[model samples]
Target: MSKPKENIFDFKLFKRLFEYIKPYKLVFYSLIVLVILLAAFSAATPYLTKYAIDNSIITREEKDFLFYIVMMLGILVVSTVFQLLFIYYATWLGQNLVVDVRIKLFNHLLRFKMKYYDNSSVGVLITRAVTDMERIADIFGQGLFMIVRDLLTMAVVFGVMIYLNLKLSLIVFAMLPLLLYATRLFQKYMKKAFEEVRTEVSNLNSFVQERLTGMKILQLFTRENIEYDNFKAINERHKKGWLKTVWYNSIFFPIAELSASITIGLVAWYGGLNVVLNEGGVSQGDLVAFIMFIPMLFRPLRQIADKFNTLQMGMVAATRVFKVIDTTSQIDDHGTYIAENFEGAISFDKVYFNYVEDETVLKGISFDVEAGETIAIVGATGAGKSTIINLLSRFYEIKSGMITVDGIDIKDVTLASLRTQIAVVLQDVFLFADTIMNNITLNHPEITEAQVYQAAKDIGIHDFIMSLPNGYQYNVKERGVMLSSGQRQLISFLRAYVTNPSILVLDEATSSVDSYSEQLIQNATDKITKGRTSIVIAHRLATIQKADQIIVMDAGEIVEKGTHDELLKKENGYYKNLYEVQFLKEHVA
Candidate 1:
C-alpha cells in the first residue's frame, strides 16, 4: 500500500487553483450574492409561517392569513429561482475553469524534458490530466460556494430560532458539541480513506492500461491466470479503500440524524410545555417555527462535514497537478537563433552522456559529416548507436559536449528551428489512428495530397498504397495495428520524405522486416537520401555498403571510421568483423 500524500493543506497549491477563477471573478461574486439571497429567502419562510400562525390562526384573523400565505408562496418561488441560477453558474464556472486547467497542464506536459516521461507512468499522467481534473472541478462546483450557501442558511436559521424563543433555541443547540465532535472525527478518518482511494484509483488505472497494452504478450506466455489474480488483488484493495469511507459515513450520518432528532424532541417538549402551561414565555407560533428551524440548523452541519471532505479531496488532486506544473524538467528554449538556410553540416565534439549517473552511454565521442554526406553508424546492441541519434535531435542533452549544425551550436538555436531541419524515421514506426494521407502529412497543411502521392511514387510505394481499400483515405487504426510492420515502415519513410528535411535519420529503419519489405524500404531510402545529409543506423551492414562513410562503434567510442571498402580492408577491424558475421549469417539463412 502506497502511503498517501501527508499534507493536503498546501496553501500554495490552493492559491494556484484559485488563479484559474480569476477570469470569472464577476460570476464568482454574483454567486456569493445569490448564495446570500438563497439563504435569506429560505430563512424567511418559517418566520412567515410563524407570523400567520400568531397573527391570523391563533388570534382568529382570517383576512391577514391569506396575505402571509401568498408571501410565503412567493418566497418559495424566489428561492427556487435563485437555487437554479446558483447551480447553473457554479457548474458553468467549474467546467470552464477545468478546461483552462487541463489545457495548461497538457501544455506544460508537452514542454517537459523527455527524461520526465522516462521516469513517469503514462497511466498516472493520464489520471492527472483527466480524472483528477474532474475532482478539482468539484472544488468550485459543489465544494466551496455550496458550503458557503449551506453555512449561511444555517446561520440565518440560528438567528431566527433565537429571535422566536431563547430558551428553546438554547435547548436545541445543547446537542451541538456531540455532533461537532463526531464530525471532527469523521473528517480525520475520511481524509485518510479518500487518500487511499485516490492512490488505488491511479494504481488500478495504470494496471489496467498496461495489461491491455501487453495482452498479446501475456496470452503468448500463458500468464492470463497470473495476471487475473493480480488484478483481483488490486481491485480488492480498491474496494477496501472505498468501503472504509462507506463505513465512516454509516457511522457519522446516523449520529448526526440521532442528534438532530434529539434536538427536535427537546424543542418540541420545552416549547409545547410552555405554551400549554400558558407561561407567557413561548407562543404557539414560536413553537411551530422552532420545529422547522431545528432541521434547517442541523442539516447544514451534516452537509458541511461532507462538503469539507470534497474540498479536501480537490485540494489533494490540485496538489498533485500543481506539483507537475511546478516541475522545472524542461529543455531551455530561450535561444533566439533561427537558421534561415540550414545546410545540414553536423559535428559532435568529445560528447559524453549518461542516462544514469556514473554509467556513461557515450564517452568522449567525436564525429563530423559534411553537407549532403551519407554517414552510417553500426555496432552491436548497447554500443551507443541510438544514443548518437537521440543526442543529435536534442531528445536528451549530452552531459559534457557540443553538438553543432552548420557551424552553429545546436543548443544556441531554438528547438523548433533545429528539429524542423531534421526528420527521424525510427525502426518502430508509430502511426496515428487516421487516414493514410493524414498519417503521411501529419496534418501539415503545407504537405498536400499531391505532394504525398508524388513522394510515394518516387519511393516506389505508390502502387502498394493505391492498392489499399480507399487508398489514401484508408484509416490505419491505432498505432497502425491494421498495417504490417513493413507497411508501417514504408508509410514512415513517406512521412519523413515529404518533410524535405535538410538532414534525414533512419535509425535501424530496416532492421525488422521481410526481404521484400526491405527491398521496398531500400528503394525508398535511396530516393530520399539522394543529395540529402543522411545518418543511417543499421544492424544490417548490407544496407550501408554504398555509404560515403561508415562509423563503427564499440562500447561507447568510435572504434572505426572510414568508407565501407577502406574499413573492410583493415585486418581485424570492428567494421570488418561485424560485416563478416552478418554476411555469414545472411548466406547461412
Candidate 2:
C-alpha cells in the first residue's frame, strides 16, 4: 500500500482563494447578519417558553399568556423568513464567485506554454476546473453558513445558561472541554480519510478519460478483457478508500452522540438536585429551557463536525487547482514590437537546441533564406527537420544563438504579430465541427464567400464541395471525422491560402493523401508559394524537385544543399542515396 500524503498548508493559496470572493464582500456581510438574526431568534425561543411556564403556569398569571404565545409564534415566522433570504443570497454569491474564478482559471490556462500541458494530465486539469470549483462553491454556500450559525448559537446558548443558573451552567460548561478534545482527535483522522478519498477520485477520473480517448486502440488490439480487469482494479481501490472514510465517520458520529447524551444527563441530574435542595432554586421553566438549550448547543457541535468534512474536501481541491496556476512557463513573451508587415527574410545564427539537456536534437546550425524564396528540407525521421520549423515559429526558443526575421531578432517581435504573418499546414489535418466555409475562412474571418469559393477552386476541392448536399453550409462532425483525410487536408490548405501570409511552412503536407489529391495539393502549393517565403519539409524527393534550393540533413546537421538536379549529380551524397531509394521503390510498385 502507498503511504498517506502529507498536508501542506499553503497560506498564499488560501489568500488567492479569498481574493476571488472579495468582490462580494457586501453580500457576505449581509449573509452574516442574517445568520446572526436567525440564531438570536432561535436562542430567544427557550427563554420565552421559560417565562411562560414560571410566570403564567406556575404563579397562575393567565392575563398575558395569549400575548406571549403570539409573540413566540411571530418570532418563528420572522426567523424563517430571514433564514431563507440569507441562504438565497449566500448561495447566489458563491455560485457567481465560482463562475468568475473558473473563467479566470481557464483563460490563464490558455495562455500557458505547451510545456505545461506536456507535463500535466488532461484528467487532472479537467477535474480541477469542473469538480474542484464545485467543491469550493459548496464550502462557500453551505459550509460557511453552518460555521457561522453554529458558533453564534453556541455563544448565545452558553451565555443564557450562565445567567439563568450559575452552578448548573458551570456543570454544563465542564463537559465542553471533553467535547473539544474529542473533536480535535476526530478532525485529524477525518482529514486523512478525506484526502485519501480525493486521491482515489482523481485516479478513477484519469482511468476513465484515458480509456475513452483510446477506446479505438483497445478494440483494435482485442484487449477488452484486459482493460476491463484494469478498470475493475481501479474501481475496487476507490471503493476501499470510500469504505475507510465511511468507517471513520461512523465511529465519529456515535462517539459525538454518546458524549452529548452524557452531558444532557449530567445537566438534568445536577439541576434536579439543586431544585430538591431549595424550593425555588430552579423553576420548572428554567429546567425546560435548559433542556432545550442543551440540544441547540449539541446540534451546532454536530454541524461543526460536518462542516469540517466539507472544508477538508475543499482544501484538497484548492491545492490541486493552485498547482496548475502556480506553474511558470519556460518561454516568456514580453516583446512589445509589432510589425505592420513581414518581408519573410529568416536567418539562423549558430542556433542550438535540445528537448532534454543531455541529448542534443539540433547542433550549431546556421542558414539564411531570402524573402520570397522557396527552401525544402529533406531528411530522415529524427534528422531535426521539424525542429527547424518549430524554432522559426518561435514555438521553442533556441538554447544558444538567435534567429531573426525581417532583420529583427525573433524574440524582439511580439509573438502574436510574428505568428500572424506565418501560416503552417501539417501532415495531420484538424478541423472543427462546423461548415466547410467556416473552416476555409478560419484564418481570416473577414474573408468574403466569393474568396472562399475561389480559394477552394484553386485548391481543387471546389468541385467536390459543390457536389455535396449542403456545400459550404454542411455541418462537419467532431474533428471533421465525417470527411475523408484528403478532404480535410484540402480544407486546411484552403484555410492557409485565405490568410495570405508572407511566410508559409508545410511539414509533409501531401504525405497523407493519394496521388490524385497530392497533385492538387502540389498545384495549390505552387500558387501559394508564388510570392511568399516557403519552407517545405518532405520525405518525397519528387515533391521538391522544382524547389529553388533543397537542403539534405543527417544527425541534426545539414550534409548537402543544392537544386534537385545538382544534388542528384553527387552520387555518393545523402540526398543522392535518398533519391535513388525512393526511385527504386516507385519503379517496383
Candidate 3:
C-alpha cells in the first residue's frame, strides 16, 4: 500500500468541501444546537448521580434521592431525542450535499473534450463520482458532526470533573498527554491506510469493469483462468489495503482501552487517599462522578481518532472529485453561430491536425462540398478518411485550418447548433441499454413516437423492428448486444433520419452489416441524401458509385478526385486502383 502524493490533511481542501454544505446551513446549524444540548445533558447526568449519592442515599434522604433519580432519567430521555434528531438531520445534510456535488461533477464531465475521455479510465471516474462521493458524505453524516459532538462531550466532562474534585481532575490530566500522543499516531497511520484502500478499490474497479465488458473475448480465447488469477491478485491488493486499516485499529484500540483503564484506576487510588486524608473534602459521590467522567473523556478521544480518519478519507475523495471538476480541457463551444436555416456547404481550407504533437494525421488537406452534394471519401486504412469526418464534426480541434459551414467558421458556431445541424452515423453503432424507442428518440420530447415509427417505416426497418417481441419498446441491452449488428445499424439509421439534420455523415456505416442490411441501408441512404449535404466515408466501392464526387486520399493528402467513371479512366489512379482491388477482385473470384 502506497501513500498519497498530495498533502494528507489540507485545510484548503476541507474549506472547499464545506462550500457544498453551505446550502444546507440551517440543518447543520440545528444539528450543532442538538449536539451542544446533548453534551450539556450528559455533563449534568454525572453531577445528578453524585448529588444523589451524597445528599440523598448516604444521608438517607428518600425525597432527595427520588428527585435526583427522576431528574437523571428525564435528562437521559431528552438527550436520546437530541441524539436521534442529530443523526437523522446530519444524514439528510450529507445526502443532499453529496447529491449536489455529484450532479455538478457529472455535468462538468459532460463538458470535457472527447480527448479527455480517450486518455482517461471510465472505471476510475465512476469510483470518483459514486464511491468517492459516498466517502465525502460519511464526513458529514458520521464523521465531522461526531467529532464536534465528541469534543464538546469531552470538554463538558472535563469541566464537570474539575468542579466535582480538583485533585482528582489533576490526576486525570496526568494521562492526557499520553492519550493525545497515541491518538495522533493512530490518525497519521490510519490516514495512509485509508488512502491505500481507496486507491486499491479504484484499481479493482477498473480491472473488473474492463474484464466484464470484454468477458466474451476472454472466454472465446480460453484465457478465463489467466484473467481470474489476475483478478484474484488485484482483489488481494484490495483486501490487503483494508487489512492495514484493521492492523492500525488492532494496535490503537487496546492501547486506548489500557490508557483509559489506567486513568480510572489512578483516579480511584488518588481519590481514595484524598478521602482518607480529608484532602479537598473528596467524598465517595465526588469520587464516583469523577470516575464516571474518566470513561466519558477517554471514549471521546478514541472516537475522535476514528472520526478523523473518516474526515481524512473524505478530504482525499473530495480532492479527486475536485480534480475532475477543475479540469479545463474541454471543447471550446464559444462560437456565436446559430443556424436558423443552415445551407450545409462545408469547406476545409489548408487544414492540418494531429492527435499527438509533431505526428500529423491530416496535413494541409483542403476540400469543398456544395449544399445537397453527396461526396464520398475513400482511402485505405490510416489514410485520414475518417479523420476528415471527425474534423468536420469538430470532435477534435484542428491544429491550423478553417472548417466552415455556410462560409461561417465552425469555431465561430456554438457546438449545440453545429452538432444539431449534423447527424453522424458511426461505423460501430452504440445503443444504450434502453428501450428501442428511447434509443431512437434519445428522450427528445420534440421527436414523438409517430415521427419515429414513420422514420423507421421510411427506412424499411419497420417490419423487422415490429417482429421483435416488444416491437420498438424492446431494451437493446448493453451495447445492443441482444440485437444483430445489422439490426443495430438500422436503429442508428432511424435515429439519424428522425433528426432531419442539414448534414448527414455515414462513416463505414454499412461496412460491417450483412448483405440484406447493406441493401436496406443503400435504399435508406438514397432517401436521406436526396437534398441533405451527405459525407460518406466508405471502403465499399459499390456503395459510392453514384456519389456526385469521390475524393481519393493516401498518406493524409488527396491523391485523386472525380466521378466513379471518370476516375476509372485513369489507369494507375489511386481511386481506380482501389476500385479494382475492392470490386474487380471480387467479380474475378
Name the lDDT of candidate 1.
0.89
List the candidate 3 regions with Cα displacement exceeding 4 Å.
1-8, 276-280, 587-589
Model 1 over residues 1-589: C-alpha lDDT tens digits? 9998555356777687778889999998999999999988877988988999999998989889999989988988888888999999998888899999899999999988888999998888999999889989998898888889998998899888888888988998789899989988888888889889889999999999999988899999999999999999999999999999999999999999999999888888888898889988888889888888888888999998889888878877887888888898888887689966578899999999999889999999999999989999989899999999988888888899899999899889899888888999999899999999999998988888898989888888899988999999999999999999989999998899999999999999997788898988888788878888999998665667878999989899999999989998999988888878885577467
Please tell me which model should have the higher lDDT, number 1 or number 2. Answer: 1
In each prediction, how many residue pairs overlap at the backbone (N, C-alpha, C within less than 3 A)?
A: 0, 0, 0
Please tell me which model should have the higher TM-score, number 1 or number 2: 1
The lDDT of model 3 is 0.89
Q: Which stretches of candidate 1 lie over 4 Å from their true place?
A: 1-10, 587-589
Residue 148's lDDT within candidate 1 is 92
Per-residue lDDT of candidate 2, residues 194-231 (tens digit) = 77887888888888998987888999999899999999
Give the Å shift of residue 64 in candidate 3: 0.6
Name the lDDT value of residue 442 in candidate 3: 92
Q: Higher-TM-score candidate among 2 and 3?
A: 3
RMSD of each candidate relative to the true structure? 2.3, 2.9, 2.2
Q: Deviation in angstroms for 227 in model 1?
A: 0.7
Residues 1-589 of candidate 3: C-alpha lDDT, one tens digit per residue: 9965655468787788788878888887898899898888878888998899999888999999999988989888888888899999988998999999999999999888777898888899999999999998988898889999999999899888877778788888999999899888888888889889889988998898999999989999999999989999999999999999889989988998999899899988988888888876789899889888888999999999988888888877888889999989788888887876678899999999998889999989998999999999999899999898888778899999899999999999898888888999999999999999999999998999999989988989999999998999888899999899999998998899899999999999998899899999999999999988999998766667889999989889988888989999998888877877786875475
- Residue 517 error for model 3, in Å? 1.1
